[model samples]
Target: MMKLEGALYPWRFRVVLGLLGLMVAAICWRIIDLQVLDHAFLQGQGDARSVRHVPIPAHRGLITDRNGEPLAVSTPVTTLWANGKELQAGKDRWSALAAALGQEPKAFAARLEENAGREFMYLVRGLTPEQGQSVLDLKVPGVYSIEEFRRFYPAGEVTAHVVGFTDIDDHGREGVELAFDQWLSGVPGKREVLKDRRGRLIKDVQVTRNAKAGKALALSIDLRLQYLAHRELRNVVTEFGAKGASLVMLDVKTGEVLAMVNQPTYNPNNRRNLQPAMMRNRAMIDVFEPGSTVKPFSMSAALESGRWKPTDTVDVYPGTLQIGKYTIRDVSKNEGVLDLTGILIKSSNVGISKIAFDIGAEPIYNVMQQVGLGQDTGLGFPGERVGNLPNHRIWPKAETATLAYGYGLSVTAIQLAHAYAVLANNGRSIPMTMTRADGRVQDGVQVIPEATAKTIQGMLQQVVEAPTGVFRAKVPAYHVGGKSGTARKATVGTKGYTANAYRSLFAGFAPISNPRIAMVVVVDEPSTGAYFGGLISAPVFGKVMAGALRLMNIAPDNLTPADVQPAVAVTIPRGLAR
Candidate 1:
């Protein structure tokens, strides 16, 4: 029995030793494979479970005015995020989490449930740092805060239409914001990060994509002039009880828009009650019949024809004339003849029509086109309207006559201002821009002869200085020259016009000897008894130009106070004899 037990032990020991040797060999092979042949695969699997590719948000660019005043800017903000799965695991503590986040417990739980499959979800966005820190104090699992940026407009509603506003995703939605979005938006970056079980960022491993910060943009708007225009336009719109109003002031020499304002504007910072209508930059977008404002351009065309002189007389007998079927009449009574300058000063529609008919349509069309009618201002502004001027080749006699007197053609306020700027620049038409200039004057297209421009400029001065002229547009201590226009509003969805609804317009320049500013003001559908451009719009031009000149420290050409008339009181509704 002892001999049999010893043999059995030896056999069992051999078998156990062989099995242990095989197990050790297998373990060694696995270690070799993991450390050498399959190291990258194993490392990738481990990283998938713990490491993450996180986004590094970049800051947006700043927007400033010509004077370096901040118009649109971005500030750091905190955005709350959560790991839904981890948040769901702490359902028992949801009430505390909800209290910290200012949310109802049930709703918070439901939200977690809705995003149960999501690894990350936004809890709330745009929180103050204090609010975010309070959230962190809760120490709720899966709750986190991401650094973000929120847009802020320092000028608020004052520059809203120009600076515009951005959306929740930091994209510009209107105005210069949208126009130069690509130039203003930043490029985000990515980095490999190590996260803990609770989804907190443990360590940054390496940068995958480098972030590129956005470049700053400087605009041509002067905040000082912008405020002036905004305040004056609002006041005039309210005083005249008009439907709406728009005004644009330009640096005549550079064609840089100094100020552009539209009434009924919206505050870009607070867009809680934003309306689509309030987003329009009306000076560049809205088009209307310019009424008698086109007279200067027409007169320019006539002078260019060499058939009409500044002193040539046109007989406007009884202030009415008949074309094929349409009867052209002046707003006021006239029994005699008017020279070229008198025609503009009195705004005689019949006299201008006769001049347009004599010169033919092609010449007038050429002059208007050269002066920037029927063309874009090249401002690249969003929703800018290129006004309508029909091809002169197809003009009927009646249409031609109407076109001469500022009807049957459409123009925007900016277009009118551009035309006046051409005259102000002594017949050189510089391309308009919305960006800051380098103080170098660009060569421009010579639209009219310099001599002709000077003659017309003098005539326009008469429109301000003559007793029958636009007295309201006369600025103190400056030689102001402008034309007043009162055109009946063309009915929408129809071809006729409304007698009561009028678009009052005034287009002119200040310090006429050496023109510094050319501006245009349009008051749409004035409901008050006083609806003439001379009554409502001219006064606004005078006040704004006076303020602008003083602000710019421009030397007044007419220092003699006696040459300037007393400030006219426009509160009362004057009788519209015209």
Candidate 2:
């Protein structure tokens, strides 16, 4: 073998050796460039695909009732997102992803086409933990899930108008949510994270910024009272076949809204086919001619004037009065004169009109304004209506007469409740609030004399005590003071009031001996059967007040009550009756 040919064979071996040497030299040069010359650049390139600044979600505030019962709260949820660029390689697996998202394959494919150009895309939002985990188990490239919040209303439609709701992105959209968005939505934080090529989170590197949780809001509603009112109002509306209805109860001492409920309400949790009308807080937003509910205010004005007395009477002979083109009439045709208390109990529009003309409009106007009619309640509700009250020192006989009997002027259910509160609070106009006061909050402005309020309370009690009065409004063992109103609805896009359509209302306070609560019930356009305040609305007031009184632990005042009196009290005045 040593003696073999040394010509072509030796040259071939030399060629192989030279090639190996060149390969070793090239490896050394590459090592120098990576370790010294371009080290920072190479390391940065490696990190570019892995390092990420991720958002750390912050929770929204809790909205609770005055008794610490949760009305609205934010629960942790998951929102799935995708890195569109990375997901392109896994297009074939999209059908599986779409199935997890509860989407049709063709629909999901079409959506992908629209979002293909984007670097990131939202896949599904507001998913439960199990729902989100099911999709993530697929391990599809570029798919990720982030924690978020979904608002939940515990009281459902019962507290819908007051608690409101948020959008998919956790933004407050209505009710108290819209009113206090800034205070309820806190700042989101950020963190440094390491992710794999598929956009899957590998590790949390460090917290870049800490998240700030939202502030908790305590509302003025009492959950027990709210539930009671909601149940009673819904039952009445359904049974009466009413177009709409509203009920508001107030803590006369604190001026706090204890319970406010509306019929045809929408559940904030599931607002898929919600109508705009269903979302209105009708207790404060919808305005109507209060009908005879405002007669209490007229009576307040009468008592405050010193020109009229409880024993005074008005002539309602034919039960109808001709004031210009308008004809005011009582529900029943009367043959004799009536006292002030009798006029209110019978809801005599003719009798009330005579009193208004006798006293002039100024006194009635002043008392109505003082008791929060024709003005906003100052509660700052989103779509609250201020109502209408014409303030003219010189009034037409028609306008003044209509004002006395609860027409020509407009008011909201809450406004009527507030006015009754002034009477319940011993003639003081307390500042109405939707938020709970700390302790012993006494905010009041005098709207009438204490003696006048007490006297009116006694007179109102007679309205519920008389056999022809609102027998339905009388709580079993409570001294209820209430007024009934049956107002003809103004024809839509017309001037005159409609005959068949009516707004039934009953505003009253319980435990007249020591008034602590005032409530108003309004049923609009009762479609079937009775539409009078004494029939539909007064029954709701009685039912709700019965439950509310017991739940609030308030003592009943009618411990030693008198028998039901005769309807007609024929006390004649010197010149006022007729």
Query: In TM-score terms, which candidate is top?
Result: 1
Pairs in steric clash, model 1: none
For all predicted structures, in order, the TM-scores are: 0.90, 0.87
lDDT of 2 by residue, 381-427 (tens): 78788989987767989889988888788889888999999998889
Which pairs clash inside model 2?
Answer: none
Q: Candidate 1 lDDT, tens digit per residue, 1-578? A: 33446474677776887899999999999999999998998999888989999887877789999989999888878898888888877788888878877899898888788999898899888888888988888888888888888899999888888888888888988888899999999998998999876677889899999888788998888999999999999999888789889999889899898998998899887888988888888888888988899898889889988998888999999888887678999987694899999999889989998998898877888888899987888888898899899885577888888888888889999999999999999999999888888586889989899999999899999999998888999988889899999989898899899768999999999889899899999998889779999999999999999999999888889878676679877664567544
Cα error of candidate 1 at position 313, Å: 0.9
Q: Report lDDT (CA) for all predictions.
A: 0.88, 0.88
